[model samples]
Target: MSAPQHPAHAQVPHVLAAEPPRSRPSSIEHELPKVGKIVFRVQGIPLEVTLEGLEKSFKSHFKRSNSQENTIDTGLSSLVPCCYGSGHQTALIQFQPQTPKRLESLAPGRCYDFEDPDFQCRITIDQDFMGSTQLYPTISNLRIEADVVAIPGINGHAYGSWTGASKQNRKTMWLRDFMRKDFHTCRTMIFGYHSALLEHYAHTMSDYTEDLLQEVTRARGNAEEMGRPIIFMGHSFGGILITHSIVKAWISKQPGRLCGSILNNFKGAIFFGTPHQGLQHLDELLEAVKKNQGRKALLESIKFGNRDLEDTLSAFKRYCQETKLEVVSIKESRETRKATKGELGELARNGELVMFVAVAFSELKLPENLETTAMAEGDHSSLIYEQGGYV
Candidate 1:
């Protein structure tokens, strides 16, 4: 098995070689005082609106409220675009230092209407914990068996990516809400990062992989926690990131080190609609990014037939072979709607719908004993939430 290649063009932007291990006293660390931070998702935002404009609108609304006291210690912390659906844009808003009363005032499921001469839009607000990585509380009296971490793909939300609306229109996060019924003792977690298509300061693939490695290591602090068995579930491009991270852990030489422990305790992996070969619509997406003047570093790295990605896959296969890691690949059986130029100049889903990743590309050609392939009923985006036979 050959080691993974890191070509000159794919070098990390920052030096990470000398970084020391993060410290945590125990697995169950003491909880800190609440900072009164709240994050919400704003859906149906107009593409032309800037982050500054959105913040200003929120501030103006608060000022016009009758009770000015609620606005005293509250302020916008960050806003980033996220993928919700086709034909429209969405953003996540974070506010901090507000009282419990303020939180009740701006409750989840609340709707805000922003009206102006040029811009008029109604946005629905829902509580969001997209970028934070934390363990879900285990069921009482259930002895913990393993940790299952889920990572969302490109333009995917930590919460929304794995969530789907039920018949009653209630959002369901299957990993947290349903997985425990069967794997009763396994702790679940959702990992998120900035993978927006038009992000201005998008980090490199190496940067994201490093962040995942460090964050998860810190989350599972101490030797006992690190030695516990673990499984990873990744959707779309997230599967690629996991492959790289696992390969790094496999090659770590230091015995009893965190990275090596991750490799040692890695139990299995589940890939949802991942393009192990390459994305079919890479050219179209690249052209769109060029026309919009968005950053292209991340896209270029996953371009069709990219040599580096091919090498990474090769290395991952070798690791799996040596470790006999359990693997499952779930391919989308439906076509996904593509975003295209709209009549009002915003991206819409009027373009031709296509199967972005075919079954051949989604399923790896690993030995039959180690790999299993199945097809799911939904398109790429909904595959994560779909209760298909694959599960």
Candidate 2:
């Protein structure tokens, strides 16, 4: 599929400073170790904290706590900022692979106190997804029958986007905890990309679409594996990316080619709160971008009556009709809280939020029986979490 051309003003520098390099192929193996190799979320961090400062404090704390044991390794592998809420900052902390028993000592739900000469803070820690682009093995005896890949929307975390606070106020990642139990024979995976709405040098939607295709191709490995049935689950803008990817694969289909193999095995897709037509609050979001000096290329492509989005959706529908691919559209029924920039550069709540995408805009007008539609109980951001019962 030919990528749509945007106005010159929508173009930005191609340099992707925020996006990390593609993860090592071996690091995303289907089977993962039970202990040392883990990614966890840290909450309650002050907005002013820097990655360097956070790392230094963690290293110091870990070293002090494990000083009695000379053999313990207290090295950190990576620390990247993640978005969980509006008021405070959150991050994903990953430890070095060599520390096989580290998690046993510092388990989830543990709180840590970090004291610095400049400031002091308390943070809560919890386990995150095993790794980006890795498959989640089934817990049942049922044999693996299909692959389910999930992609989060703009400003969404691969883990946090699918996770939500339950009625008991406990964080529940539905993909790992709930979907695995229900789809016993299906291997699930989550794809992460740099889609922050406010990023200054963010990649275009085409860039993300290509990255997703390449990662899935690498993850599937051999030809037989690539030919296995696959279902895609996308939320918000994620659904747009998925549509572009499928259309790309369909256009590039050829015998024995990777894209062809993927398109051949593509069986279905599920979209949660995806704006198939466009967002209802496009002007408001654009205004927010202007006020905050944010990137606009991606947002511009998804505005109401956007030629690119309409073309992509049309092509996606055509592909589904010819291939008989099943599709499920889950629309959000509530309003999502909007975050505004405060005087201190922190994101603050701006009164009551408005619905970003309307129900009509969220649903795809597919041919008669080609698509199934359902309404979810939460807002746009929470629609993915609502899939627990919908699935």
Candidate 3:
């Protein structure tokens, strides 16, 4: 018997190298953080507190601390808390870079460790500050008007999914190769998150959407990028995430704010192999990975159908009606197989049989779109790494 063979297109080599980013700022500038401001998550404070109360609590803990009384700390430039009733109990602190370690020393774990009856919650540094710092193209001479933002699926690395050191090191990412030849003029930013979907501390889609908004705002800073056209590219579960973010922008009362700006910047989106409808069988997937498997987070996050997916899709359809944001959906044509319980058992019985073959094809029940293309030769994962084919 002959071994399974890939399509002719799959054999094509990635001959093109990634191009260097533009030196001058084009229509958009990817803003890097200056050491002037630091954002912190102030959790545990009662959600019912007034804006004034929130600020006062922060000041008491950071400024007039139990350790140091009567003296106001001069290092803090200002504390900007979120809106009074906003679910996010957070504050942004602008301070001198000279006292970098002061905030940590005060909060220890970035959580307020002080004993305050009114505000007893812990404070931690925002993920935007620690791990997923926005890294976009450096400001060049060009006056950038628009750009692209790419987000990877579950457990997908910000850089790796689109470029080097892929999740499994199987192939070079198509995004890297695509950008060089097709969308060279666009300034691209790859968004990353802590998508540990199964862990007790795992973040949900809403959390990811919020973080994405914050990251984009942080990267753009005071720049006026919202008025310009923006293109979004999401792969796998990222498609759902980007969709939710856009919907949030639409429903947001403050269209002038960061979340609003994200949606207001009308443009298009390209989704690759995103399960628009939903996946089936959480139990079987979980069984495959076992309780403590590393990929458990991903399966747990994506398992079967959930309300989040349906609600987001509904919102997405509404958002499309209200705006002219172009949509593109790409579905994979090839089928891939996985090991199954019965098949695995048979394999174990027959020493010659190495693995089970539970074959399946994956595709989205694509929402209405400006264009829909099918990658005839590609499967779920291969379509993503199809080397410069589509952008």
Better of 1 and 3 by TM-score: 1
C-alpha positional error of residue 334 in candidate 1 after TM-score superposition, expressed in Å: 0.7
Q: All candidates: CA RMSD in angstroms?
A: 14.8, 14.5, 13.7
| lDDT value for model 2 | 0.60
Candidate 2 root-mean-square deviation in Å? 14.5
Per-model TM values vs. the true structure: 0.66, 0.66, 0.53
Q: Over all chains combined, what TM-score does candidate 1 have?
A: 0.66
Q: Write the per-residue lDDT of candidate 3 for residues 328-358, one digit (tens) a residue.
A: 6655565533323355321111112211111
Who wins the lDDT comparison? 1
lDDT of 2 by residue, 142-245 (tens): 55577778888776677667765554444456565444444546667787676555546567777878888877776676655677788788888888889999
Per-residue error (Å), model 2, residue 119? 36
Off by over 4 Å in 3: 1-141, 164-171, 196-200, 288-304, 339-371, 386-391
- Relative to the unseen true structure, what is the C-alpha lDDT of residue 329 in candidate 1, on a scale of 0 to 100? 79
Which prediction has more favorable TM-score, 2 or 3?
A: 2
Per-residue lDDT for 36 in model 3? 26
| Candidates' C-alpha lDDT | 0.61, 0.60, 0.48
Clashes of each: 0, 0, 16
Lowest summed-lDDT stretch of 10 residues in model 2?
A: 4-13
